[model samples]
Target: MQFNPVTFAIPVFVALIVAELLWARRRQPRAYESRDTATSLAIGLGSTVAGGLTAAAVLAMLVWAHSATPLSIGWAWWAWPLCFVLDDLAYYTFHRSAHRVRWFWASHVNHHSSQHYNLSTALRQSWTGFFAASFIFRLPLAFAGFEPGMILACGGFNLIYQFWIHTESIKRMPHWFEAVMNTPSHHRVHHAVNARYLDRNYAGTFIIWDKLFGTFAAEDDADQIRYGIVHQIGSFNPLKVVFHEWLAIARDVWRAPWRHKLSYLWREPGWSHDGSRETSDMIRRRWNAAATDQKD
Candidate 1:
């Protein structure tokens, strides 16, 4: 029998909950001003647990379906290390696509909802992920002759590696290790909303994917990172978290042309007007400028 992820992963779950509680206690003063941070977290966590377990059940079915046959296409259990890398390649594609599509981004936007970045924030995964991230793309792996169990296991493996990097500690890895794999340093950049840090470094285990694909960006010490999106939802409410961007998407779709409507679902999140009106950067700045001008 293979190692059960729920069994092995218990330590991670327990540790995160304990650590986040301690962190919450320490930051109670700041959290009050942030207004109901605990409430948002409670709802968000419930949704995340429900959503994650639901997804796991769905993934398990695929694994069981392809496990018995002599027709498994992926490498053997011994060769799963390579399959891990392949799994990450597909992950990168799914991630990039998720950001590109508004509907997909709606489910994913929750992970980035927090203005604060920490382990708990990482666990603040969206519940509606099933609607956006189906097993459609990964099915290709099954068809390519790879065993579903191997592929699904690799998916879990990728997610496990990705979890610890959600910390503020462990700033960097060794020079050699940092050169190849995704370190916390790279992940910190991914969480930043700073103009330069918006969408860089999407690799799970290998930084090589980002380097090869031109999405890599080195972290800077001089400029402190401001975490979260340009437009902060400022709530831990799971319903709001999952539907906030979706609401924005619906508004954009209402007035948009047929071509624009379709593109909003298929193109990048900030894509607008055939590159005519404004960039996401420009829109954020303009909104801020207008707010400032009103204040003055």
Candidate 2:
């Protein structure tokens, strides 16, 4: 309930953007990123404003209806802590679903479309991603008696905390810290294009969630990661960026055999028996490989 949409999200969001541009300039003042900054910013800014207003309206109405005559909005206060756990758990489900569901991946892939992994690239968020995974995970909050306010606070906190881990500046952490939380090291692997690094380290806050769920992959300093997706999305148009994947999914689904409908939702991205194996099975065969193997 303490989460004000603007107060919680805007500050960190602004700070991250400012920091990224500063870091990029300091690293090399003349090196302009090939990606379109103006278009990316437009998409990011537009999505944030539209999504925030729509989400706020939905939540406000939901909370009001639940807080009828006898109850007050403050009733949501008691559920704040549970909101954190529920939101994180829901986020895990949300992420996992985004990967498993082909239709959803189209909306979700915008985050991975860039060939370079930088702060500006992080802002290349999808404009229409939530539609793919929002339904299944959000209903639990309502069922658990969490008014809209509490749910919003928990969701906002997870997102705000995750912003800083998107960079390449920070490297490995001290033993215990890396064990429990998501660091740049872990997130780097998540953004990696090398087959071994794809789709791992999906945690938002506590890296332990990935550890417990068996999705964590330690950084490998030896084989430097190549950032971006297999087929880079070439356009800078925000409209194209948002809907491109959805279009791919529709084409794929139309061409897919009827028996494979369910499998389409579970198969790995870019997977088609008709295609190539980008990452060999042996590369990701183990989870806790020695640090020596991880040196990139």
Candidate 3:
């Protein structure tokens, strides 16, 4: 059986969420909305169930891939840390692709749907990740000789490390820690719908990956951060939150010309056949241009 640290951390996750709720009450009431929290929890539960159903198949594939490879890193103590760091890098790659590629983004967008950023919002996971083939990202580790179980355990720890950072409770960490790790401040920029912050800070555990890869964007206190997608679904319905993007993709593909149909599935989010919509990059360009004009 694949060892998943997230399974053991469920109780701790609950306690921390409750503590965050109380803190929100005393500090930031808007941080926790009733319906939004319920929807996020419901989606998270479904995502867990979805992942459970697919876990065995994913592990089996990883094992098969590992068997095909001649290299074996084995279960050495050093392998554990090495596997974790590599797994985090894999997450960074998957995450960056998930934003840049619409098919992957459809599965990832649910995690960013909530307008609120709190511990509970961290629970907002995607139910269709398996359908989107996100597990493909970790397959490289299997091919590289890391054991499938070790890769999973490391990925679980990565998830756990990310949970607390999805909040407004703590503004920033120590300068050194913030520079090295993915903190609330950095992650907030990731989740923000602000044009300046769009498609940035995709680090899973270590902020170093984003820093190295040039995807890092620091949080600016002067500009208020608005959470959620560019086109807000404007609903608390969990099913809508989970399937809206997929449905949109289907509709866009069906309606587009045959030559452009596949583009709808693979192109960046907000791409349009007729230049009718704006992707994050387009939005950022416009914002920058307007700012430059105003300064002139």
Candidate 4:
């Protein structure tokens, strides 16, 4: 069994979620809804079971890639920090693609399915992430000579860093920290379904990547954040939450012309051959145009 920091952090995760629940009840009674939290936790448990079943095969591929590469970067003191930065970049790339590509979004949409932003929302992971092959983004680090174990450690730590940022509790950090780190405020924008925030802030641990890529969007106080996908799901069933988008994709692809079948799978979410739907970029542009007209 590999040493997974996220596995060890499970107890800590539970403790914080309980503490948050107590705090929410006293401070904001509506912050934690019974059905919503249960749904998030259920989806999270399903993700864990799915991850466990697929971990061995994922690890095998990483090990094979590392062995085939001639570069042998050992675990030196500096190597750890280097791996962390590199892995964070990998995460940003994979996370951005997951939002843009329909095939990947089918697995990722569940995480944003929750309307309430709280600690438990962080655990609402994807049940089909292993099959999505997003982990292929990290293979480059292995081939670059970073040890497989080291890469995994950095990846785990990256995930742990993101867990605390899923809350609505901490409004914002100091300007300096908020400028670099992926704080709760930035993450709120990422989870938002609001037009201006739809496809922005795709960072995992560091906000720098989003800033550099022009994808960062600060949370706006004037326009409050609305979490979840653009088209919300009504069901709290774990199976429904995890696979709804995928089922939708299957139906859409099945009905499309053969020439357009691949487009249905690879195009952005909300894409349509008949121009009836809108992608994130299209949504944001329309919002921006409306704002401009108002200003004019």
lDDT per residue for candidate 3 within 1-296, as digits (tens), equals 67889989989999999999998899899999999999988988998999899999899989998999998999999999999999999999999999999999999999999998999999988898889999999999999999988988899999999999988989889999998999999999999999999999999999999989899999999999999999998999999999999999999999999999999989999999999999999999999999899999
- Write one digit per residue (lDDT tens) for candidate 4, span 48-115: 99988988888888999999999999989999999999999999999999999999999999999998
- The TM-score values for the models, in the order shown, are 0.79, 0.79, 0.99, 0.99
Q: Which stretches of candidate 3 lie over 4 Å from their true place?
A: none
Across residues 1-296, which tens digit of lDDT does each residue of candidate 2 receive?
33555455666666776776687788854323655666656777866765665665557555655554443334545567667776787888777667655666776777766655555555666566446545446656655566666677677677766767767767777889898877888888887867677678888777878888888788888879887666777787778777786786677678878886555556666665455443223344543364447874
Error of 2 at 185 (Å): 1.6
Model 1 lDDT, residue 163, Cα: 73
- Supply candidate 2's per-residue lDDT for 200: 83
Reference-based lDDT, each prediction:
0.70, 0.67, 0.93, 0.93
Give candidate 3's TM-score: 0.99
Per-residue lDDT, model 1, residue 168, is 66
- Arrange candidates by TM-score, descending: 3, 4, 1, 2
Range of the 10 consecutive residues with the lowest summed lDDT in candidate 1: 28-37
Candidate 1, superposed: residue stretches over 4 Å from native: 1-8, 20-44, 47-49, 52-57, 60-71, 274-296
Model 2, residue 291: what's the lDDT? 42
Screening candidate 1 with a backbone cut-off below 3 angstroms (N, C-alpha, C), the clashing residue pairs are 40-236, 73-145, 73-146, 74-146
- RMSD (Cα, Å) for all candidates, in order, is 5.5, 4.9, 0.7, 0.8
**lDDT for residue 179 in candidate 1, whole number 0-100:** 84
